[model samples]
Target: MAPEPEEKDGEFVSTGSVLRQVLFGLVVAFSTLMTGFTSAWPVVLPKLQENPRSFNVTDQDVAWLVSVQGIVGMCTSLLSGHMVEYFGPRKLLLINLFPTFGLWLLMAFTSFLSVLYLCRIGLCISTYIIKSFFQAYIAELCQAKIRGAIAALPELIISVGVLVIYILANFFSYEVVTALCAVPFLPLFFLAIFLPESPYWLMRRNRTDDVKASLQRLRGQRENVNNEVKVLTRTSKVQVSAWSQIHELRKRENILPILLVLSILSLREISGQTALFSYSVYMFRQAGVEMDAFLCTVLLGCVRVVTTIIAVPALDRAGRRPFLIGSSVICGTSQLVIGFTLLMEIPGASWVPLAGLLIYVAAFGLGQAGIPWILMGELLPTPVRSIGSSIITFTYCLLMFIVNYIFFWLLANIRLGGTLCLFAFANVILVIIAYFWLPETKGRSLENLEVAFVKRKRLDQNDHDSNHEVTIELPLS
Candidate 1:
């Protein structure tokens, strides 16, 4: 690795460290590309439903196939969160590759509906574990100054994966696509082996030398990482039982961050991105778009990738709060345009939904799709990071399953226009909450954030003591 980049006036002045971090992030983020493949695989399900190539399947079966990952994900997320805390991310990630490869192999060859359901469950385990841990891993790896940009890489790569799978599906059989998904794992395994473990995790286990060595590798061999090691020593000193960590959540300092992250993630689900991407083709057809729905879905993927590429780099510069608020506004407006255009039955407006979808995907890709996950790492304190993240991940998957399971019903009961308008209204709520309450995490170290909360708790206690003293001093009231 190159030497650590220089810091000038508190900003990174060279690309060497940032480049190294991004490279590591991208390699680890390849796991998330599998998430994209699984998410977009539903686009091909309708075609399979038309033919039932080798297995007998129904619309209900297809819905189960599409939504079952979320159920399995909820369970695995809790396990993986604990696993990440115990074994650390690097080992857990390497162990994850075995199941991921095996599941893809099964997917490539399976003909039975039961076996395919089993494969989806395995896929969810591999990918969602990565989803649950990688953000925490990357946040530990990179500095706060450039953390937002580096953390956002996974979202960008996921979009690219979606676009790639869409293009491949146009010309290849589902089996071929399934087989090809396994190929990336070979490189991922080799690349992941060389990446350093999280120094914070190392510190928690009393591996002081290993923590320094890991910090050296992450910061570059030429750099002196002693200061960083000292910070890790201070911040990661708490070693407690998992139940004790869970009890920590009852405190104001810990629970407030959990609430912040949970609210953000809940709002992310309510924004309908998961349901939108999962059912993009069906949604396009329902909107009466004259363009080919598959083609429009592919375009949506392309636009998502391009916009995320452009927008992610600006995240650290513009800060998370503004990016999220701006992205929410555009998303709401685009949904409204689509809803109005469809509901009014405007003549020659068959093209409107496609146009609106492109705009929505672009805006959603800009920040909404990525930032909440990034916050999962930034906001959660070390003492409760694992449990807090697990709880949030469980809720996220549950909401995802609910939204996906009920999406068609929502469209049937209220029409596409009304369903989209409901999603738009969600954005409105997100914007209001975010503007007033979301703290600016840009350029703030994770250690500093933890200390800030501790200080706030102290101040609150001091105020309470002062009030008690005043009550004692009063004669009669």
Candidate 2:
């Protein structure tokens, strides 16, 4: 489609203005910051558990606190996608932030646990919506050459947010930490009000002039963006209502990409990032590491931040499939060894789980954490991207909800080592799926990828036996 959008020397070529593109990406990254806040309770909870007025909570209660956000996020993610269609992406961000800003302010004025839960749920809605928003916005706006790097930016910022929470938790009490988290949302809320709406979305609405203006601003005045704008105009918009998105998946046009994305997204959760970091202190404590839990967690947070920074460039050149398979193997091994050690109660190597957890988090940051979302943005078409993303994101939260809700029970029933062993097995299976089924999206424009996959889907329908067509060939690097 579109003759593969001219590349230079076999590399993906991007033409957007650097300053405007980076600025837009930086501003939207705030969404991930709040999402990180939604999940950072573990780092702050060691102190919360000790405070008498903070309500008597057990390990199970803390787990519920981390998971209930997913419950709320799962319910609202699809609705947020439709809201993006009805009001546009910029407005969606503003609407999403209101509850978080208001709730956190109220929580600061009171120490009630119930209020804290309400605040967490409120931000989770924003968190999931923002998660959906970034995928849609970048899918619609980014140049192919930089897409992998740009897509990783939000997750990178999310790691930074977790790091900030960890650093703050080192000194602040529960109430003060909650208040500090709320402060950033104030500036972010105002920034969302002023950011440009997705240009592709405007094209769908047939707002020609606004589309041109947005393109000019995004691509720079002197640079030519007419061909790109015209390309966006030709893409289809979803005609079906949001409730009927499932029915769309049955069509030959939608089935393969949707299945591939759902598999990756679901596997991403089961990869254990949430189970490891959101509850890192608990897991580390179970390992019987002599080091203080908070200190160890802070180190984990720093590792997450550093490794994510390293992954941005890697995803672009090394491509998605290699990192997904390579990182999965490493993460699986670490989880398996850590699980074995803890299950056996190996004496004196309390360092085993911590060492494994560090490696797991680092490898996770390198690939599993960032690449799937990039592919999610790449594979889906503009026509149904909102609903497609909603379905994908809803599955993300729902799977994460299951992981968090059952995490402690899994620990209690199977013991720490056994729970980790389960994750390890799941990751091992993921590597096989990724190699045989996942496609390489590096060096391709969103339009080119959509056309090629759609073409392949049509061909499979005709041949019915071209099974070899299921997986793609990546560049031999």
Candidate 3:
């Protein structure tokens, strides 16, 4: 086997090359446009409430509109990695975008709950494709050191898109909102028309010249393209099937990382993140904040956008494990305090919960919100990355559904504080697990991670061999 490439003193690629940066920016913009619907949903809640009778939709029915999106999103997420691997990111992304854009346009005309649900499912599938492909695409493009930073651009743009939609929806009609959603696809359609396929994808296919040309165009370094292509080609092995790749992972020490990714994602969902967003108005109303609940939710969206902006530069600098551990601590504490405030029936307790909730959002934005997706893409080897990422996404979506379902049920039965407390405890557990098990992947190359696992497994095998030899010698007597 060829020796693995070592990180050289100056070989650390930066996202500074103008053309590459422009491409990266375009990709991020596409992600933001794709994600605009998420924040827009909160903004449109009031509109849905205003004409609930016209649509014959109940609060529970509207919630399903959101919930069904989450359901289909999870399903697509679990499957998307394989789709990306099989079909390639460029093709899958382009194919997914048309339906996604079409769904938004269709949603503008739909008053029927069934049609709305179908549109949401289509949106979910598109979002899933976008999320998986975008992450994998960035991962394949950037070097290890700046992977977190590059990966973070999508999340940052997502925040900006949310803020923009929140502002627009505040002033615009539902039709305008639908049009704004469609507008993102127009630019993305043009960009996809010219965008090169991922070099790593080409490498996987053994098209070395195509990989080299792609890297040359994407990185703006014609000479270095061959070197990078050589590195990727050296390690590239074709898997016959997605299931076969997943089975290979099962035979490796991939369990801990998989568990950690799932736990991080589960904690993110179950911690009432979406519940707070979905029911922000109701929570504030109960607290007697006396503000327009829709406005409050929009304000909340603004806060999230601002905090995520702050997180962008800090994420790569602070390292992953610290952010994960620290955020969990903050999230847990905030949830507990908010729960207690609600439970105590303190005067102006609504402010307390609101403040805690904002802090929780900030903490999440700083850490789990963006980090899990980055880590999910980074932790696995190239061969199984698509399958592994999909699995993680699948688990995340399933947990999200369970959490949202339980949250709604609990909100009615136990009230707000009790519901939040459940998430608080879950966050506490996540903190402990993350502290103990999650290794810092900051600045570590993907190849190094693979070697580390391989070496560890070899050491374990040697230990087992020694033990067996000792047992045999003693038994001979």
Candidate 4:
């Protein structure tokens, strides 16, 4: 038989390889379903608000039902990372699907606040687990050049789910909406049944044959499987344990990238996009929208979905930093306009707020929604990616919880304009941070980024040395 075709060197790997694309698409669908269901609360919030007693709850208690989910998700993010590494992404995801489906079923029938709280917490934990694992898995599986585009799949699916849920909620009962929310999970559960385990995980475990099979399935060729396996094996060997890996990352050399990732993730939350998602219905209500709150929320979700579609093709083309800085500016400006409109009580201010809100959502979809996860995957060296990703996600989730909690309190006490103005100021700060610190990773290979950081650090040190030498010579003279 003729020798197997040699793997191409420096060739572009197609993310659209039939099997990989299908697998990625399936993962995206599951992610979207999870996110969509979580976000669907906004559409259902008003009904829960109106009939609090139907669920044997006060409005304040019902608010906690939503709040608790975020709180639990935030708390679980760190643990979820370890769990993913230990059990593997496929297994963790399959486990999460159970509670994810169960929670919706519970919501459909529960009459007690305690039961509702428990189910929400369960859903939150499941979400945290799946999101952390899915992100890491996608990063590990995709070739560096196309990783960002593949990473964007989850966010795209999320928007789709949001749009679907919103539409369904507008025309259906809460029970029907919950049932519909659970439908996506059915396909996901079935599809996942036959999906291969993550090859990186298999390599790490020294399951050579299994690793080769996974690589063949994911990459659709056997020629490069051994090389890929070797790289992953070397990386895995270096990361013997999570804590040791994390400690290694604390060195001064790693500080810049670490700080950059943390800052981006932090600013992502402080930018107030998620707060808006959690409170969209309430904000629209404050804007003097007389329609049903659920309908308004569906409108907002539709806007988000449409804008996200507009963003996909542009993401790899526009580059990360440009979109981030541009979105920050747009988001900040929109918030300022909306805040001032509320403050001045301008006539037709309702439309002004509505327009501002739409702009804010659009900007968020264009940048902050997916970019942080993409950056997290790209910023770290292979040896520490898992631990580093966990830390970044932990910071992100913690900040999300704090923001959402404070958001509810702020909305209760502060005027709508003031609340938005605060977020605008936060976005302005993020723009400055992005300008000075966040590097452009677009089109750069992961190995190239690793080298770039090292080279940058070395260059910085050399400049410092030259400046010191010049100062010493002048003083001696």
Candidate 5:
């Protein structure tokens, strides 16, 4: 991989080019909008179960609609890395949306539970494919200094998508709401056609002229694109074989980051937050909330959006490790607060879960939400990036499916308060672990971050040697 940009944080800060990079990110990031809605659609499932005649589905049928998406997503994520690397990010993103558009067409015209299953399958499969590309895209296009804000773009887009779905599901029939979901892909996909392909990918193909043009567009006409061009050329040659990538994991640097990526992805997805989002209405109903469940869900979506907006700027300025630690502590505390309030049956504190969840998600938005993704792309070398992203995203989807499938069982078997408390305790543990393992990547180049781990490991070994010599000296005396 190329060395860190000399300007460090100057990629966007000093240039007029940031706007072009931002626009490019927004277009690519649009898929997360689809992802947000797909995540939100589960909330509608409980309603479907309540009134089967309108949808011709059973509780069992409704249950499969969600778990199946995760299963499909897991499978899709594994392949997405190769798809993007070979076919290219721009084309993969465009083609992948067809399945999403087609699925939504099914949803708008039919109410069969089977169609919902297909809708979810296409939605999730397309999403992970887009995500693999987006991660690579953001890492390559933007400078390190501003990468955090761009990387966090998904969280904000997703929140907006969820809020839109929640509100639409309230007034519209399922069919109409689905059609609304499908509508955006048409314009977004076309807009992407005009956008520059990843300059790195272009360079990898030895398409030097295209790379030059792409850099000109992204870095601005007046800015010097030649140095950026050299980095891409140097980094993309003679792509590393898959065997070498697998071998790379044996190294301390490779292993540590991947492990950190795995832990962070697993913790968030399996945290029952999706269940928290999906079953918000049911959760409130079961808890005897007097307010409208739909309205409360809309409120939840709003909280997510607002907090993510707050997080975007801080990602670059405050650094990544703090957000991960702070978000975990706050989320853990919020979960604890919710658990206590519910178990104690506090009078007139029906709003406690709402308040706690608000804080939890806000904290999550500020750090945990964006850092894992940034690390996923940054930590892995270019040769291993594709496979590494695939593994992490695949693990993420599989865990998400498992959590969604079993969350209710946990709530029933252990009680909502107990289940939440467990997640709370987990966040506390993660906060401790993350403090030691999570490297600070904010405003630093990906190559520099990787080398930092290697340097730390080297220093640690030297310290160990010094200690061993002292022990030997003591024995001689």
Candidate 6:
């Protein structure tokens, strides 16, 4: 077994080891940034509609454009787990970039509405796969202490991409903006060539030498990673058939984490994240803000990026549970405020909705935006991690599809305030569930987390036995 690394702030604190992790995290984050670009591409919806050369596009068309990605993502997300297992995240991510790059170009040159929708469909598939791959990739690559922050990098980069597009949409032609969106993939393809394969994945393939080599690169040469290698090697030995894997998922350990993760993701989308991301410009416009909607949307993106940046370090220090609970509280409150402000149409208070939205974005980026993805990587056991993520991502996309598809209908029928009130109510529920149910995964290794989940299930089942004791320890040398 390798000697234990020094501990600081609950993470194994080695500056050299941490620096390597951060560099790899940044390269992977570029792919995530492209997803962000695709998500916020609709910021150009108004421009596309107004351009004489572009196809005639209606509000209905915009809704379809926004919501279609979710449906497309649902189809592709199921394949992500299997694909990651087969091709490995590094190779799959590189392959995904090709379709993504070409699709961006297709959107850049084509003004036809049908072609644009097809391009969006293609991009959605690529991005969903990218999202799933990176979550699994980072989970396997980084140590437990900094895992949350590294996993959250995608969400932060996504926000940066969103902000970049919002600013660029104001200045660039739609063609130029779409063309520029392809830029990330170019560098990411080259940089990702240097990204180390997951030590865990290598272990599962019976490549102990490769696993050790991968771990050394990820952990830095001075660090001993033998103990980590042994742990993964042991995990890899427990291979199972597809039916056995399905049966394994029914166990309390697996079921509990799945339910908890799905709850977080479902609440996230139900609280209107998809609607906000896809239609912020339109949402602000419909809210009747006296301020420029595009500018307001850019400001909202800035808040998202800044708050997520602040949360990155804090994620390791303060822990996941508190951030989630706090975020839900703030998000619910902000939405409630926005709903009432719009409901009353309070004379001389046109800024309230926009202000509330900025508050919402800040709170969301601070916790909700990144935590679920972090938790997804942390909670599931390695044997079940791939398939579990696929199921979770599939459901997430399904919910996103439903939310964006009906957003305008809700706005029209319930009014914007009523619709927002519904989202606020959903957040209030999330606060309660997170407060009581979610586990604290700070500074714990992935292997330790697996044991914790199983013991947690045993404790739940044997509640009457007060004599029973369970202690989950962090990994030692």
For each candidate, how many residue pairs have backbone atoms clashing (under 3 Å)?
Answer: 0, 0, 0, 0, 0, 1
Per-residue lDDT over 238-313 for candidate 4, one digit per residue giving the tens place of the 0 to 100 score: 4546776677676643555766778877876887878887778778888675666656666677777777776766
**Which has the higher TM-score value, candidate number 4 or candidate number 5?**
5
List runs of model 6 lying over 4 Å from the truth. Answer: 1-13, 52-61, 111-115, 236-242, 344-346, 456-477
Misplaced by over 4 Å in model 3 are: 1-22, 45-60, 110-115, 288-292, 347-350, 455-477
Top candidate on TM-score is 1
lDDT of each: 0.79, 0.74, 0.68, 0.68, 0.72, 0.79
Residue 329 C-alpha lDDT in model 4: 91
Off by over 4 Å in 4: 1-9, 12-19, 45-55, 111-113, 206-209, 233-237, 252-255, 288-296, 412-414, 455-477
TM values, all candidates? 0.90, 0.87, 0.86, 0.85, 0.87, 0.89
Clashing pairs in 6: 2-227
Per-residue lDDT tens digits for candidate 1, residues 91-117, read: 998888766777878877888888888
Q: Which of the two, 1 or 2, has more TM-score?
A: 1
Tens digit per residue, CA lDDT, model 6, 254-287: 6677777888889988999778766787788888
lDDT of 3 by residue, 68-181 (tens): 766787778767877887788877777877566678777776767688777767777777777765776776666666666777767777777777877877787766676667
- Across 1-477, the per-residue lDDT of candidate 5 in tens digits comes to 112222243333545787878888778777678778777776565555555554576666767776777788788877777777787777887888766766777776665656666667767777768776687778877778667888888878888888888888777775677778888887887888877877877876678999999888887888887866765665564344456567766766556666767788788766666677777777777666677776776777787788889988888888777787888888888889998888888899887877777777777777777777877877666656777788888898787777777777887897778878877876876776676666566776653454444532233333321121111000100
Clashing pairs in model 4, backbone N/Cα/C closer than 3 A? none
In order of TM-score, best first, we have 1, 6, 2, 5, 3, 4
Better of 4 and 5 by lDDT: 5
For model 5, the stretches where C-alpha displacement exceeds 4 angstroms are: 1-7, 10-15, 45-55, 111-116, 205-209, 234-237, 346-348, 456-477
Better of 3 and 5 by lDDT: 5
